[model samples]
Target: MNFAPTPRTTSLRSPEKLRYDKATAYDVLDAAHICHLGYVHDGTPRVLPTAYARIDDRLYFHGSTGSRAFLSARDEGVEVCATVTIEDGIVFARSWFHHSVNYRCVMAHGRARLVQDPDRRLQALAAMIDTLADGRSADSRPPSAKELAQTAVLELALTEVSVKVRRGGPNDDAEDLSLPHWAGHLPLATVAGEPVPDTGIGVRPPPYLP
Candidate 1:
């Protein structure tokens, strides 16, 4: 809840609005199901989009045990930049040049580590379930020994992070204010649909879709 705001130094004129507070950042992290990960591997930059979850002050990621990134993370424990962005709307301005998008994004700097402890791995697995389905995490059965052997879990400590967001109507320059182009923001959002039962499921189930 008390993180410092790192100003956007890319622009001298119109800098981005930022929500760098730690609690706000966590809110955004929890809202997203996936994050784009950036790291250096084999002296080359790598960016991969993958599913993730959060627990306490650490972010959780899972991948194939043999995945190059996963292995690299476990072996070298290199610093990484994990980002999550969700576009909420399209900002239409009077001029075509002022087009912008309303979005929430978080960029974190941390070292990724493999979850070697069995108890911690189980906790990470449960956190992952809770992230996807609130109550289902408790309703689900614990993973068997065989199942545990087949999964890989990683934890990224949240020591340094930045959360930047933009939300509002179109922004146009003074000269383009009078342009006749259509102007305003077209709202965008993720809407949940009705839950569809599995092929073998016979009776109507409770709300399970999101």
Candidate 2:
């Protein structure tokens, strides 16, 4: 399935990099652990980094009940944009103008609604834990009533979205190729480090620990 582009989703800057396919958008979102949630509060635009999870065609993010963003969205059902980006490499070119970075990003636009259903909220929370670390939700304790009460979960339908990707080396001018400067892309990635056990825990590390 492909998302029909709207005025907000159409990438006017780089039409070639713009993608309307749902699979591409979902792939970018699945590979990312965090997203930047953009919304307006008090007539001011605000962007906040948040942990999120995608289930089917919906994206879910949670925060403290006292959070201003959540509160505003819950009350007004404000339009929001959720974006996730994964940096793949740093492209270096002989000329600075041609230098760029390789990345995969997805932008989702929708109106966020507070998740009030207990079952749905639980599912979203569990999905979040599992998204961060697969199988971690089963290995850890579930949220208690008090904890659930203090948390605010918001859901945004994935009806409008776009994916953008850039890869390979920099596109340098033909004349600048022989400028005697090295030109190549430095690959980058995110990898897990050694697990550090808690001071009071004697349990063996779970298999899910990367």
lDDT scores in order:
0.80, 0.92
Please list the Cα RMSD from the true structure of every candidate, rounded to 1 decimal place: 2.5, 1.1
Q: Which ten residues in a row have the lowest lDDT in candidate 2?
A: 201-210
Instruction: Give the clashing pairs for model 1.
Output: none
lDDT per residue (tens digit) for residues 1-210 in model 2 = 999999999966879989999988988888888999999888999999999999999999999999998888777576899999999999999999999999999999999999999999999999999998898899889999999999999999999999999999989999997899999999999998777888997657788887
Model 2 ranges off by over 4 Å: none
Candidate 1 positional error at 183, Å:
0.5
Angstrom error of the Cα, residue 48, model 2: value is: 0.7
Estimate candidate 1's alpha-carbon lDDT, on a 0 to 1 scale: 0.80
